[model samples]
Target: MASEVVALVNPNTEAALPFATTLQLVVGQATEKGRKSQNEDAIGIRIPSGLALITKGVVSVISDGVSTAEGGAHASAISVSNFLADYYSTPESWGVQTSSSKVLTALNRWLYGLGQDYRDARRGFVCTFSALVFKSCSVHMLHVGDSRIYRFRHGELLQLTHDHSTNINSSNQYLTRALGMDVNLDVDYKTLSVEVDDVYLMTTDGVHDVLTEFEIHQKLTVLCQQHSTLSDDLCEQFCLMLNKKAFDLGSKDNLSSQLLSVSQLPKQAIDDVYQSLSSQPFPPPLSVGMKLDGYQVTHTLHQSQRSQVYRVVNDQGEAFCMKTPSVNYIDDAAYIERFMLESWIGQRINSTHVVKVVELQKIKSALYYVTEFLSGISLGEWLTQHKKAPVEEVLLLLKQIELGIRAFHRRETLHQDLKPDNIFITREGVVKIIDFGSCYIKGVAEISSPLTRDRILGTADYTAPEVILGYQADGRADLFSLAVIAFEMLAGQLPFKGKLEKCRTRQDYQRLDYISVHQLNPMVPEWMDNALKKALNIDPNLRQADTCELIHQLTTAKANQTVKDFVPLIARNPVRFWQVISIALFLCLVASLLNN
Candidate 1:
C-alpha cells in the first residue's frame, strides 16, 4: 500500500522580486511497508492559492494507524484526508488555534464514536496524527500518538512535537493518546516563526524510533552543506534512505517521511507589487453622453479621490453604473488593486442588502467595472431627510444593514469602512451596503504583499477604537461600526460626539463619555440605548461579541425608566443644571442681604 505522492506546490503568485520575502516550499515524501501485511501510514499536503494561502495556510499531515486495528490502512487514510479537507473549510475569521482545534476536536470525537462500537479498541479505527500548518510567518504543529514533526535548519535538527506514548519495554511501547483511543482527546499544539531556506520534516515512529537524533542531524547537515537547496528528487531520495536505514536496523513497521524546504519568503519591496497593480492604463473619466465599449454614459453618479462612478446604459438599454479608477492613482497600483477588489467582492457577495456587480460579457477597453445602477438615496441623505426618524423605521433599516454586514462576516470579510455614505436606502424601503474598497478579507490579509495598508481605513468617528489604534480588526470591529450607524439613525447624532478623535490612547478612549440615546431621542427606549452602548463600547473587548447578540438586545424590550436614572443631570440638560445652580446661589445671597 506504499505510494509515492510528493511535491506540494505553493500556488500563490510567483514573486517578481529577485530577493522575494514570500514563502516558497518544495516538498518530497517516501513511504514503505517494510515486512508489513499492509501499509498503515498516510501522508497529505495542501498549498493553497492567493487568498486561501493567507487565510487557511499550507498544511502537511502524516498518520500511522495502529497495527492492532482491523482496518489500519483505512484508518490512516481517513484520518489524514478528513483533517486536510475539514481544516480548509473552517471559518477564516477564526485564528489558527481556534480553527484547527475545532476541526481536530470534531474529527477526534467522530473517530472515538466509531471505535466505541467495537468490543476491542484494537479492532476499531485508531491512528497517530501529526500535522504542520504554514501560515503568515509562523509554523503551527498539532500532534497526537507517536507521530512526530521535526525542523532541520542551520545544521541543527530540532524535534517540534512530543510523542504521546509510554515505554512498556524497549521493544514494545504503548500509545498513551490517539485519535480513537478514548472519547476525550488531547492534541499537542505549538507555534514557531519560520525563516527562508528552513527544512521541515514529518515522520512516523517507524523511522524516528530506529534512528538516533545525532545520526539524523548528521545526514541532514551533510545534505545542506553539499547543496544550498536540494532538488525535489534529492529530497525524496534522502527520505527513502532514512526509511531504508531504519529498516536495516531491525525495524519491521511501516515507514514514512515528508520533507519541505522553504525556498523563498514574501519580499518587503513594493516596486514589483506596484508594477503588477498598475499594468493597466487608467480609464479616462467618462462624462455625460460619452460612449465606451458600447456603454453610453448617461450621467456622472459619484466622484471621490479614489474613483469615479458614472450611470451608463448598454446598447440593449440596460442601465448600469460604470466605476473607473481615478487618474490620481494611475501610478499607484496598490490603490488600483484595492479599487478592483471592491468589484471582486461585490461580485462574490450575493445579498439584496449588498450592491451587485454587473457581469461584463465583453472585453473592456479600459480599467473599469460595471455594477447594477441602484435607484436609491444614500443613507446619509436619508438621515438628513429624517432628522428624528421613528425608532421602528430606523430599526428596520438597521436590521437590513446588519444582514448585509453578516454576509461579509460569514465569508470572513469585514467592511472596514462602513458609514452612512456607503449605505443605500432604496425607494422601496430596502437598505443595502455599498463600497467594499475598504473591506478586509482575513484570508487575503495573510498573504504577504508589498503594499502596506496598516493604518485604519475607516472614519474615526464610526470606526472601532482598536482599528484606530493600529490593531487587527475582526468581526467585532464591524459590529462597533454598525452600532454607530444605528445610533446615528436613531438619535441623529453620534454617541461619543467627536470624543473618539481626541482619544490618542486607550486610556483616553476609556475616559470618553457615552451620551444616552434617550437623551437625544426620547423615542428610543432605555434597553435599546443600553444595547447600543454595549455595541459602541470604545474598547472592542467591551463591545458585543457579534451582530446577532447586539440585534437581539436591540429588539428585546425592557422596563422603561427615567433618562435621569441612567444619565447625569449635567449630561442630560447642561443648561438646566447650570441654571439651577445659579438660582440656588442667588437665593442664599438674597437671604444673607435681608439678615444684614
Candidate 2:
C-alpha cells in the first residue's frame, strides 16, 4: 500500500540556521562628529520580518574612516550603507558568510576604484568596517578594522572583534588593515551561537579605543535585562550615553555606537515535527484511478521496497510527482523521519537545477508529499543512448550538477545519495537533481537524537571510502560520487570495473584498482583522463578538494601533465606512511625478543 503524501513544511519556512530561528530584535544607534568637522563614522541596523527574518536575519554594521584619508567620511558611509543594501539583495539561498563576503569583496573593489585617480592611495577612500549578522539564533561576525563588536550575556560583557592595528613602540599605532586599502579585502569572519536576551554592542575606534571595556559593560548591564521584551527607550539611551561618554573621556575623533538586543527566538522544533508526523499511520496503497487527498494518480512512475513514486494531477490540472513511503517499514521511526526530511530539505534548496517540493494549497489527509513533475529522462536513461558523449558536453553537464549540489551545500546540506538515477535532464535541457531521502543537514545533525542517523548512505559504487568506513561525510564525499559519474559518462562503464560496490571493508577497497578511462575510450585526452583519475582516487584525500578544482583541471590542463596509474600509499601523506612503517617494524622486533 502507498503511504498518503503530505509535504512537511519547516516552521521557519526557510531551514533554520545551525540553531534557533525567527529572532526578534530591538536595535538603537547614535553617532557624533566629536571634535571633527564631519562625522567620518557610519552605523546601521536592519531587521527583516517574516520569511526573510529567518533566511536573511538582522544586519548591523559600523565603519570608521581612516584618520589620514581625504574621503574617510564618504568611504565609511558607503561601506555601511551599500553593505546593508547589497547583503539582503544577494540570493536568499546564500549563507550569511557567503553573502557578506561577496558584498564586501565587491564593495571594496568599488571603493578602491574610486581612489585610483588620486596619488598616494592612502589619501583617498579608506575605512575600517565591522559587521554582525544575527540569523536564526546564530551570529555571523565579519570585521576588517579596529571597529568593535561585543556581546553582553549572563551578566558578563565579552569583546567579539579583534583590533587589527599593530603597535609602534607601544606608544603609537597606524592602521595596518582597512577597507579600500588594497585590491583584495581580507576580513576576519566567524559564526557563533546567540541566546535569548543576548545583547550586541558595536562601536568605532573613537568610542571603543577611548572608553575602557569596563565602561561599555556598565552601559550594557543597565540597558539589557532578562526578558523576552525589548526596551527601545533604554537601548537608545544606552547608545547616546555610550558615544557621549567616549567624547567626555577625552576623545577627539568621530564616534558611533549601535546596540541590538535579542527579545525572542524561535524554539528548536525541527525534530519534534518529524517525530510527531512519524507516528501517523501509513495509508493503504492506491491505483491509477484512485485519489489520495486532492492528487489523482495518473501513472505509477517507479516502485521500490522502500517507497513508490507516481505521477498525479491536482483539480487545477497541475501535474506533480507524489512520493509515498512504503508500508514495509511503518514502525521504523528513523526511516520515517528521514523520509519526512526529504521534502523539508527540498523546500529550502531553491535552484533551477534542483527539483522543488511543491506545497499543495489543500490540506493533506495522508502521509505522501508532492514535487514538481518534469517531462524528462533520468541521467541513467540518457547515458544508455549516448555511451560516449562529447568532452565539452560532459563538462557542461557536470558543471550544472556541481551548481545544483552547491545550492544544498549553501544550506549546510549534503545530497549523500547522488547517482545518475537521482539526476534528471528536463525537456528544455536543464539538469535537475532529485531525491533527498539520504541527505544530511548540519543543523539537524547538531540536534541530539537517540536513533542512529549514520549507517552508510548512497550507492557503494560512488560513495567515498571515508563515508563507508563510518567517518563524517563532507563535500569530498559528493566530489567522489561526481567523479564516478564523470568516469561513467566518458568510458560508458564504472571505474574499478564495477568492483567498488562489493567493497565491504577497508582491506576490500584497498584491493580494488581503478580502471583508466583512456583504456576504455581512446577518444578521451590524457590530461582529461588524469583529472578524472585524481577525482576517482579511492583515498578521498587524494582527490580534488572541491568540484571547482576538478572542473579547472578538466577544462585547463597542466603545462606538463603526468599520468598516475594509481594512487600510491604515500599519496595521502608520505610522512604518516613512513611513521606507521617504523612503528610496525619496532613492534615486530619487540615481539621477537619476547618470544626468544
TM-score of each: 0.81, 0.79
Pairs with steric clashes in candidate 2 = 1-285, 2-285, 4-367, 4-368, 5-368, 5-369, 6-368, 6-369
Q: Using lDDT as the measure, which candidate wins?
A: 2
lDDT of 2 by residue, 478-576 (tens): 988988999999999999999888888878777777677978988888888888888877777778888778878888866416645465667655668
Which parts of model 1 are misplaced by more than 4 Å?
A: 1-24, 46-58, 67-72, 83-113, 119-124, 133-145, 164-194, 264-269, 454-456, 557-596
C-alpha RMSD (angstroms) for model 2 = 6.4
Clashing pairs in 1: 21-265, 21-266, 21-267, 22-264, 22-265, 22-266, 23-265
Model 2: number of backbone collisions = 8
